[model samples]
Target: MNYSHTTLTGDEGPQQQVTMFLTRHTKTTANAIDLIQGWSDFPLTQEGIEIARQFGRGLQGTRFAAAYCGTLTRHYETARIALDNSGNDNVEIRFEPGLREYNFGSFEGRDVSTTHQAVAEWLGYSTVEEARAARGPKFDLDVQDALYALDAENMLHTDLVPQDRAESADMVKQRMWQAMTNIGDLVSREGGGNVLVISSGTAIRQFLWTIDSEVDLTYLGNTAVTKVDYDKGTFSIEQPVGSMAYYERGAQ
Candidate 1:
């Protein structure tokens, strides 16, 4: 559980800096099922392998000091396969507990919709009826409303939930902050080189929030990669790193 770190590559000097390519793990069974996967270690689906291959194509020419991933099999396997396809044997893979997905306690490995429904019912509300009404054509209720309703319903179960099991959004943020700080310290102390981070979507979004609070984390597309520049103690968000527009198509 010692997930703290300092550097990934190069020597420490005045010219040293770190540029990170933040990426999420490719499609997985959890994703395909629309489940709440917090802390669950599910293997990737076949489609996930294909999606990860695409990500590897983006890293072909990009030099990395070292790469980091969570301890979960989905993340580690994706990193391994992607690096193999990229033919980048030089980049190291580091495993850290702080990089693991959010811990959701009893909610792990369960359908998100079912959990939402159960929580709503626990709160003494007829969620199915409400959902039906909300689903009416031209209702114009945004998806955010459903998310809020689900969150509120879950909150009502707070007393039934136990600590060391369920993780709140705030807790997830704090853990990610610690992990990134450790990575930053590494870059600050070790010098200049690219570092690729393979983490869960929410963890990556939390990093984005720390870098640019204005960016919408929930708005990112699936398996997206965002580039960030960190130099002289300042961080700036850049474009997605895996766009095909940047590189010619390689062998499929």
Candidate 2:
């Protein structure tokens, strides 16, 4: 993909576009075991490291003006590996806490299946499968909503610390937007170019939802790239959301 955008500058000086290559972190041990990673820290699995390298190899010629990732092991490692393989290791990656995954609070590190079942019950569904059938693409968002509600009501895992309650969807959306806009504005001021960002699956999905509610929220595979363009104080999602084309290219 060319990964560039052009828009009229109008009275705001020269037109500058910052293309963001927003990617999800590679697979982690938690992911392999069907655990809810949330804010819980976990290192990337061997497969994940190779996937990140492949992602980098796919972008052999692309030069990044700026690089960033959440202040988490998985996020940082994926970004580091990708940049190194892509020949952009010289770029310093800035850590952004706002880019962190949605804090699952008490639910962090729990089994994914159990978590979904609890969320389903909270949502009035008899089972997770029933919820999935009814909610379709919105199932994931509903799960987040359930988590927020449960946390707010002090209903999740009584043994877990109260402070560990899940973050509301709105909160995640706000922080993500702030972080992304900050990065975009900063890059635009510095004469616009390609920007690389590594964030978690749920965080990326929620952020994209804030930009375009109709976006497919089904799934975001590890190391998948979602391209976005920031131009004229607005953000737009480019075609081929959650793309694996780059990874496929590199794997070949």
lDDT, candidate 1, 1-252, per-residue tens? 234343445545564567777677877888898888767888899988877776677568777777778888887877777777676766678876677777766566778777667644544557845754654321111222333345445643544334535655566667776776667556666666787777887666666666666664444334566777776657778865333331223333
Question: Where's the lowest-lDDT run of ten residues in candidate 2?
Answer: 1-10
Please write out the lDDT profile of model 2 over residues 1-252, one tens digit for every residue: 122222223334454799999999998999999999888999889999899999999988899998988888998899889999999999988888889999998778889998898899988899999998998867887788789888777775466565667888888999999889878877787789999999999899999989999998869999889999999779999978899887888876
Instruction: Identify the runs in model 1 with alpha carbons over 4 angstroms from their true place.
Output: 1-15, 116-161, 219-222, 240-252
- Considering every candidate listed, which one attains the maximal TM-score? 2
Shift of residue 239 alpha carbon in model 1, Å: 3.1
What is the number of backbone collisions in each predicted candidate, taken in the order shown?
2, 1
The total of clashing pairs for model 2 equals 1
Instruction: Report the C-alpha displacement of residue 127, candidate 2, in angstroms.
Output: 1.7
lDDT for model 2: 0.86
> How much lDDT does each candidate structure score?
0.64, 0.86
List residue ranges in candidate 2 displaced over 4 A.
1-15, 157-163
